[model samples]
Target: MIEQPRHIKSIPAYKPGKSSVDGWDGPVHKLSSNENPYSPLPSVIEAMSHAVATMHRYPNMAAPELTSLLAQRYAVDEHEIAFGGGSVEVAAQLIRAFAGAGDEVMYAWRSFEAYPILVRGAGAEPVQVPLTPKLRHDLPAMLAAITPRTRVIFICTPNNPTGPAVGHDELRDFLTNVPERILVVIDEAYGHFQTDPSAARGIDLFREFVNVAVLHTFSKAYGLAGLRLGYAIAREHIQEGLRKVAMPFAVTDIAQAAGVASLAAEDELMERINVLVAERSRVEIDLAIQGWNVTPSQANFTWLELGDATDAVSAHLNSRGIIARPFSGEGIRVTIGDAAANDAVIAALADAPRPSA
Candidate 1:
């Protein structure tokens, strides 16, 4: 029998949302993962198809073309950017690079589920600051939670499983107060779906702050989740740390080709995003009409603060063939899927019993 460390054993495993309804043969609308409902653009698929011929060859470990284009796009030096299998992997790299046992990595509770897992994987203590009553990151409270051992802080904007983004003014103020030695990572995996003009842009903040690192993913808005590619932008030293810990050739050639194609087809992709944004608006309005008060979302998903009624409501939605992401006793995070999927969720919730007061 293997003896696992208590720290590793105590870490709660991340449970992903369900993709299918049990024993239901009808059309299933999976709104569990916050994935872009649209298929990859034809150009992207074409690029990936072409790259398929080189499957036998190892990928460009440096990903020079993708890095060069991203550097040009973000106006950062190529050395300041690093790539990984996903933003989550890049985050793991960041944690492994900067933190270890006895160090603390802080993030808001009920944020991205992977935060604690990643922090613990690196043998760092995870300091979870609870969100405000409104389900938003409480910057002041997070500041209060900081300690001398704090090495990394992850701020997820338009935070996962909840929809509100940290405002620019508040974030700037928070960054100003944070010690310059502590690495503050702005996780913007959902940034492309963000609509609020005043929301903090990590890229803009990266230029202003030396300790800041910005995480981006092609998984969400770019519809590249299947290919698994994400990147980070930060100071050269931080980028070097991430690169040092990154898995060799983590971003495959097919994924790199798709990334290149995705950038070239941004205009068309943005048009698709516009459609999803409109659908999000529709879902919010319809949910409100059905007597559910939802937090306004700038990201591609909407959150329902179901409290004790979460399990029941989730079951009810499952009965209707809608598999949305439910966080047990907490709340449900429903992806703003296509019109059909959104309508199914709205209709299912309309029939659900009101959430506990």
Candidate 2:
């Protein structure tokens, strides 16, 4: 028999959003993946269409044009940027680059989900610090968890399925406390939807901290989820490791073209992001008014702390054609999509019995 590591076999597979509901055939509102409701921009579509004709050739390995555009926009050196199929892919590469067997990777409990998975997949022990009472990252505790074996730390601001973000001052203090040699990855996949002035800006943090690496994706605010394009910004040594571990030409020519076009249309894209931000605010406020304990969200999605009633609430929403992400006994995360979807979600919540914690 072929031997498999116990940890590898025990690792839970990542669950993607459900697209269909049993016993229901209604038009479903896919609020599960946290995708932008808007369609791809005209310019981006045109660029991608143009690139499709070149499908016969392999994509550029370095993605120099897209990398250059991102470098110029973020005011970073070309060497500081590394592109991937998505931030998730980049994250895994970083994990493999910095950590290995018997090493430790640390992150908050109930964060991006991929953190523990990637860490364990890289043959590293995962140290998950619990979120604070307010459901925010307990950074002080995370800092304390660091030992000599801890190789990488992932900080997901506006933490997925929890909603609240870590404040700038707190992060700065934590980063200062951490040893300089340790790698601290700041995942800002939803940074563009942030309306909070105090939210830790990962790009700025990357510029300030030599050990810091910021991961960003075009999948969120740029409405290019289908394109699978994302990049990481880090110091030279870290960037080199990421580049070395990365799958060559993982980002296709079409994704690169679309990403560049999306960056060029930032003003228009920001407008759309602002709309989603406003919708998220409204949803949280409305949920609060409806006697639901909704976490204050700075991302395109808000989290409902349903505790024991999480599954029931999720079932109710699904019956109403609103597909959301639920964490069994933990909570439900509802994404802010188009107006109709938002309306459906609100209506479902309004009709739900007050969830029992």
Candidate 3:
């Protein structure tokens, strides 16, 4: 076999959620990837249709129009925004731009599985601090994990796999302790679904801390996951680095067109989000009554700490045509699907054996 870098060779690949209906004969409810259940807004589809005619031309590598739209929407300078295929690629850019061999990139373990893989792929050491008992980031512990070589830290609010977000008070306090030289990334991929009043808003934190960067995506809330568009807001200097590391022409013309159109349709999409939030509430409540140790979910998905029964229960869900993201022995993360699909999830779980701790 050809030789490969130790770090790259050891890195685990990102596992995408499977389709629940893959092997089933009946209609399937895909609650695996936390994607928007609603189809593209009428305006977005029209924009994408219009963009298809321009496929012969190379996409604007600068992403000028989309950047302008985002800057106007956020009331920030265009120079401060940098985007890539998705938040995941943006995270990779940040890691590549900042950390290198002998440096360290840190984040809470079980937060986003991509964190370690991305960091190690960049030849940087990954320092993972374990989440709290309630599945929230332990801010104080994260602070203690910092060292001179810690170049970056990722804070995934409304943390994935486990849904509780980091509190504003704790996050503000934690930011004060972190050295200004370190870049702190607030990964808010599911921020729109947040209903918690105390949840730290990344923009607010960004305004306060020069080193802080906020990541947002058009994938989850805007129903554009397939389009693969995301951006980061950081200080001018850091934004420069992100732009420097960006893969040229990574964002397609259609994606850029769709992002602008989706933003224009924000009001309509938000209405859809409100429904998912309500559904998330229902899912959590139903899970608690069903005896699953459900973490209070503030995102579009609910997490079940199923312990040893994770695989068996995942199999059960698949059998019922409910595709969910399962972490072997750890837990299962189910995306809140459409009304019919959600109702099916509740019914399936109700009918099957409860997950054993």
Against the true structure, whose TM-score is highest?
1
Candidate 2: misplaced stretches above 4 Å? none
Overall local distance difference test of candidate 3: 0.91
- The parts of candidate 3 lying over 4 Å away from their true place are 20-23
Query: What TM-score does each of the candidates earn?
Result: 0.99, 0.98, 0.97
Q: Local error of candidate 2 at 69, Å?
A: 1.3
How many Å off is the CA of 46 in candidate 1?
A: 0.6
RMSD to the hidden true structure, all candidates: 0.9, 1.1, 1.2
Locate the minimum summed-lDDT window of 10 residues in model 1.
Answer: 348-357
Give me the overall lDDT of model 1.
Answer: 0.92
| Candidate 2: residue 198 Cα off by (Å) | 0.9
lDDT of 3 by residue, 1-357 (tens): 899978889998888888645577777888889999999988999999999999999899777888898888788888889889999999999999999999999999888888988999999999999998989999999999999999999999989989999999899999999999999999999999999999989998998999999999998988899889998999999988988888999999999999989888889999999999999998889978988789998888999888788888888888888899999888999999999999988988886656653
Model 2 poorest ten-residue lDDT run: 348-357
lDDT for every model?
0.92, 0.89, 0.91
lDDT (C-alpha) at residue 91 in model 1: 95
lDDT at 353, model 2: 54
Encode model 2's per-residue lDDT on 1-357: one tens digit a residue: 998898797677899988788877877999999999999999999999999999999999788888899889889999999989999999999999999999999999989977878888988999999999788999878888889999999999878868777898889989999999899999989888887899998888887889999999999999988889888999989989988889987999999999889888999998998889888888888889998988898888989888889889899988888899999888899999988899889988999856653
Per-residue alpha-carbon lDDT of candidate 1 for residues 1-357, written as tens digits (9 for 90 to 100): 998897799788888777878878889998888999999999999999999999999999888899999999999999998899989999999999999999999999989999999998899999999999999999999999899999999999989979999999899999999999999999998898888999999989999999999999999999988889999999999988887888998899999999999999999999999999999999999998888979999899999988889999989989999888888788888999988888888888888977766
